[model samples]
Target: MKSRDFTKTGPVAMVAHACVLVVVVCLLGAAVSHAATDEADSPLTVYVAVGVLDVDEISSADQRFTINYFAQFRWVDSRLAHDGPGTIRRDITDITAPRFLILNQQKVWSSLLNVVDITPEGEAVFRQRLWGDFSQPLRLHDFPFDKHTFELPMVSFGGLEQQVIMAPDPQRSSLIADNLSVADWRILGYQTEVREIPLTNDVSVQGFVFSFEAERIFTHYVVKYIIPLFLIVMMSWVVFWIDPTEAGSQLSVAVTATLTLIAYHIALAGKLPDIPYLTRMDLFLFCSTLLVFVALVEVVLTSRLARSDRVELARQYDFYSRMVFPAAYLAAAAWALL
Candidate 1:
């Protein structure tokens, strides 16, 4: 066969050129499409702020709280640009914005005003008021004397941390000075922070955190729980001063104090969650109960001594107990509270 000319002029060569042209065009188109996709998937930065309008209720037993608050979001999207001297209202769907859900939300009430404000330059602002119950772990180890930094974290929906990042907008973030409505805590301070929260071992999402520190307004606990506890503990001490010779009266006092402390412990159990770890109050109560029990044992021993005609020795035991019991209480209180 004559050496076939494979130059472009030949029919076979022309067909081959055409196929090469199509392949090159497909590669170029694919590259352009990939660039577009990359641009679309680039990270979006949203400035976020949260303001607490009121802290309605905090339930220690349930580890949940009800709060009223408003959140504001700001972002810029060129797709939303329009000619306007001032901000104009637009439907929320018209704007490209990050959507998020409170990670700990138990129940929620929405304001239902699904609208966003847009400026001529496409700066968008979205605000919403929310009322809800949110759950959080409360560290009650200190109990009535405990201070807590309550956290509310919002994580973007359907986006990874790299896709939607949150930055705190300090100018718009604040806690209300009044109307906190929480009776047992004094607000220390509040702040907003950007955090990354893991959803799985390999996945995490950006989060906006609004947190406030509050200290227990422990005066209520002191007056309502501690003072009564002190009185009950003091009542147990009465037997130490009682004449050991009157074994009957001494037994009566000790037995009554023991029973009352037991009843009080049962009543107080309803006030807080039955956590496995002991709280400061629990420790103090335990020490008080132990002291009462010791007094009960002493009463029996002294009564036996008095009956056995060791009356002088029984008085000596009473004398020592009167001094020892109060000292023991003070030491126990310091260890538990401080």
Candidate 2:
């Protein structure tokens, strides 16, 4: 086609110029609208704090504990701002806030209605109280001397990763040492953490954790289990000191001590969870039982020697056992502890 440029400044040129201006204005508006939408879609940062009010019960058999606690959330949203300059209260249902659930909660006994405090500047504080059982995995390889770190994990429910995020509120998170009434446990310390945890193959959520460290008191086991076990095992050793010629009486005493130890084991079974692996305490108990059985075996041997008319030899065996039994037991006990 030939170029037809007559330098024409007419109605057609003006109309073409107007259409171009409209197209440029429309493109600029779409860009501005897209930027605003992105700003609105960004996740809101919520500060999370957990305050443990009381520790009601800890069940080793069930691997769970009952707790009364309150969780606090604070965030700023300009949409919630009001005309009043002071703070005002509102029901949580009426306001927009993040919802969460305890990831390991087993049962809930009760929960108080949630409340939110809103400031004129759009800062909001939300508090909710819960009483329930939370599951905790326990490792008892040390048993009476074992220390544990218990955790309660909270994750955002029904919210996407681009919708919410969590931050630790150190100023508000706390553990009430005096209110922790778990029997035979001493509270060491506590802390809070903010993290992101994967929920599924293609999804993840914001997580908050409130954790506390505790150690078993151990005095109860020392008095009620270990000391008594030591005495029962010591009773079995008495057979070695008795006159070997009196085999009947020696057998009776040894049998009685063995029966008592068996009963003790039955009583302890009720207090601990049925686990597959052995613990330090279990090792000590096994050694004690073995020593008692060995003592019983010695009594039989000495009695056989006396019956064979070798009374002097029987007495010599008894003398050696008196020293050897105690030394062996002490070594085994040390090994279990170390």
Please give the range of 10 consecutive residues that has the lowest summed lDDT in model 2: 156-165
How does each model score on TM-score? 0.83, 0.84
RMSD each, Å: 6.5, 6.1
Estimate, for each residue in 227-300, the C-alpha lDDT of model 2 and write its tens digit.
88889888888887899999998899888888888888888887779999988788988998899888888889
**Residue-wise lDDT of candidate 1 within 167-209, one digit each (tens)?**
8875665555565788887888888778787778998777888
True-structure RMSD for candidate 2: 6.1
